[model samples]
Target: MERRTKQREVIWRTIQQAGRPLGPQEVLKLAQQRLPNLGIATVYRTLKAFLEDRRIVVVEVPGHTPKYELADLKHHHHFVCRKCDRTFDVNDCPRGIKNMAPPGFVVEEHYVALKGICPDCRNHGAGD
Candidate 1:
């Protein structure tokens, strides 16, 4: 039991440190640095538990497999730099939480994502 608990902690800390969202395979690489023998199943289960407890949330990438990130931190959306593939915090105005949900569904929060070339990329492109 203690072994499993330690593995879960490592996984959680890995996700927390990732800052941006990460998929299971990515989490496995980080957690393995601490617990090399950690099973992939354990990481998956731990993330699922965290999601169920609202300790983390899902970040869908359209056609890509969804990624997971730590919840309970400051709420902000992600902007993906198309040119550099960097993720940034938009920190846009907060609103439309309740208004975006469907009937009988309550939205306590939301994360808006914008994908485009960031300022750095744009500047680099100008040089090119």
Candidate 2:
């Protein structure tokens, strides 16, 4: 059995606790708190390995770098905060988008997003 390194353990545990998809920078920050010597490249590679093994899946954010989340996450889409630039999940698909696609295009995976002000942003009056 391969021995788990401190870096890998920190990276994995940090993201696991987040309970939400996070980008590399975010992962790096979290992991660094536990293992200050952890390098950015190391975190990137660890996430890449997890993705290859299907342990974690990528969170697709339009016009942004991809994020990572545990693969076992429930079927849900993300709600990105336009103001604070955070992301949250939505249990059900957004309203009014049916299973319609281009005539020749095959729909393999669908990602529905509701782009608007989140409660946090609304309370802070930062969403405009």
Model 2 misplaced stretches (Cα beyond 4 Å): 1-4, 95-109, 118-128
Sequence-dependent TM-score of model 1:
0.67
Q: What TM-score should be assigned to candidate 2? A: 0.76
RMSD of each: 5.1, 3.5
Compose the digit string of candidate 1's lDDT tens values, residues 1-106: 6997898888989988886777788789889999999878988899999999999988774544567877776767877766655566667855666776779997
User: Model 2: per-residue lDDT, tens digit, 1-128?
Assistant: 23347777788898789977888989998888877877788888899888898989987768656778889987798878767666677788655444486577776667776677778878987435
Q: Estimate each model's TM-score.
A: 0.67, 0.76
**Model 2 steric clash pairs:** none
